[model samples]
Target: MNDTPGWASPGSAPSDGPDGKGQDSTGQNGDAQGAAPQDAVGQGPQWSKEQPPPAQWSAPSGSPGSSGSSGPGQTPPPPPPAPGQGWGGQAPGQGGWGQGPGGPGYGGWGAPPQGGGWGQGGWGGPPAAAKPGVIPLRPLGVGEILDGAVSTMRTYWRTVLGISLTVAVVTELLVVLLQGFFLNDSATTAALDDPDATPREVLNALGGLFIGTGVVLVVTLLGTIIATALLTTVTSRAVLGTSVTTGEAWRDARPQVLRLLGLTLLLPLIVAAVVFVGTVPGILVAVLGSSDGGIALAIIGGIAGFVVAIWLMIRFSLASPALMLEKQTIRKAMGRSSKLVRGSWWRVFGIQILATIITNIVSSIILIPFTFIAAAISGDGVGLLDSTGDSGWAFLIISGLGSVIGSTLTFPITAGVTVLLYIDQRIRREALDLELARAAGLQGYGTAPGATPGG
Candidate 1:
């Protein structure tokens, strides 16, 4: 029976576990070639006849502090050779490497391979180093997940930032133009706090507010779909140790754009529907009975709706990555995400929440100074401390630039984490580490020319 722990794929070599620490760091020799045996050109370890056999092991024979049949001053004898091996085999350290077995008479990891790790009698030695990629092909911990996301940004900044900045700049410029030239923000501001405002003024302000909100929502939705689709592709390639260009990402993700848009639209509408559904009973109560009772019902309904929204949001949080990466239908993508999230709702929720909080904090730190600068540069007769409804394009443009820059900086991180989080969940549940390793071109991660471990 296989003995590797829960976090690692079965029959895989010793490596890092979920805690992001290597299983064995004692510096053992790699396979007979001074590297880990590769099951494929770009994957993690897999067992086959072409690879070395498992290490040889035996139980301890002597009692503690007692040398069997020899005097106390004498050393114990070396363990027997592997089964069917001649007694004249090379001794420990003769062929170099091999920490001399993890225990007495256990001679697999350290033994010299007779066939360079694939021969009839040899066994595997130390595993090779994981190939450089967005992440190592193993179970990931929190730190590893965070690092993988950042590494993609650092490694492919040109592509990632290009996509984000392009989307950001377009949205930014458009928002500024609309706010400055089209919307009457001063009237809206006056209508908001001034109770004596005429009905026409208030109605006009409401109309402007609705238009601005609708436009903002439309642009934000478009930007998010584009960003998520392209970044998901980029991050997937990065996991395979491949670099992607913005154009390549765009082309690859183009097929899924409409589907992604549908999903993006559907999710929010679902949340809104849930919240609206909760409010219906309260509305009915107000119409049929007391206002006070309706108020209480409404508050309770809103609270319940909030809890359900958070639950559904977390449950389907991974759908976008799955949709892009798996090329699944919208319904299938949601099913896949929900399946992955079934047993580990709390863990995924916590990580998603944590990533969002960190991203927001970093963005706020970047945007605060830009806000001050925008206020200082306003020239439309609005004071620095006053609302910017009357301010000229200078304030709108400057403040919007800050938002663009902030989004550019923060977008990759948020998108990358979501992708990596999806992968991590699969690794934990479906032995996806092996596939990732193979995809990453690790030596020992897939089927070879002989018997497989699974077989």
Candidate 2:
């Protein structure tokens, strides 16, 4: 009778239980190699050549099948050789192990052939990794990560869409109201375009433009931050094949929202500071000397700074997810992001840009028709451009509806990609898949003590 754990697939050397050995024909336990058999001196009854059915193969001495020992002079067959182990040798890959075409220990009686034959491409390899969630518990491919994000959105549409739509509608409403009340004035644009306008008129126009743009930017940024936080929770839960309610997501994410906001705000500042520093020398040169030369130098410096800013942005792209998932402070989050991004900067940047492109494409597809419809309804196509400030409430409302729809659909994609990317990175670098599998309660990957789930 075989005495191996059910979970221990055939051919794998049983690491525990039953002393990891079976009695030979002489009824004596020995190394798992094809060495000379011992004489039947002090040995018990020998095993028969004919083996029992697979059903009787069970694990260890204390296990059920161990009771099927031979009585008196009767003999019982030995259990099958361990997977990846030879007739009486070590598992493949260790030195001094049996040799065969498939690395070591490729040819043992009843041992599955190495490379291909049994479960998961032959029992030579470890069992296939478990996948309790959207992705397999291993390093992910580019397509896998992207697919995982889409899967999260599809599987948890209720919670994901609810969070997205609420944030989108609220933010779009605020923007539409702001534009309808304070920003759609034609005076600001007209004055700026009028060369003969006095200094005060131009100043007023510029001031109004900056103020309107700033307000709109701040509102949009806030909306994005909130959506990202909520969806980060959702995507994370999806990884464990668990669903989360919008309220649960919010409750989990709320505590870290402020820190996320600070991190979000700080990254832009850091980028701007880099750009400003890069352009500073040119500014000084222009002030003290030739304007042409200064302008040229400033342009060059600005480009360099812009390049650096992009690098920094990609480097820190993961901070929001890190902060939300790890319950980390802004500084620690940024540092964590930096650490994860190291040696993978180009990959992170490429994925982020790809996600951005996909979202933008989707947004454009949803928004263009609404824009045309808004222009037609308002009877002022030019008014749709903020410069005219003549876009009526009808135009604002229609366009804002489009904005909401676009944001609602696109928000999950962006946030899911970022969070999944963060997870992919950790799985590659930290073997997080093991933790994830355990957390998901996979059969073989039992929870380690003190081990927590999620990032």
Compare the candidates by TM-score and give the number of the best one: 2
TM-score of decoy 1: 0.71
Minimal lDDT window, size 10, model 1: 22-31
Report the CA-based lDDT of candidate 1 relative to the real structure: 0.70
lDDT of 2 by residue, 88-201 (tens): 444554323232222223344234323333254333433445667787777777888889988988888898899999999999999998998889888776888897999999
Winning model by lDDT? 2
lDDT of 1 by residue, 189-300 (tens): 6786788988988888788788887888788779878888999999999988899888889999999999999999999988998888888888889889888999889889
Query: Local distance difference test, per candidate?
Result: 0.70, 0.75
RMSD (Cα, Å) of model 1? 14.3
Q: List CA RMSD, all candidates.
A: 14.3, 11.1
Poorly placed runs, candidate 1 (over 4 Å): 1-129, 198-204, 379-389, 446-455
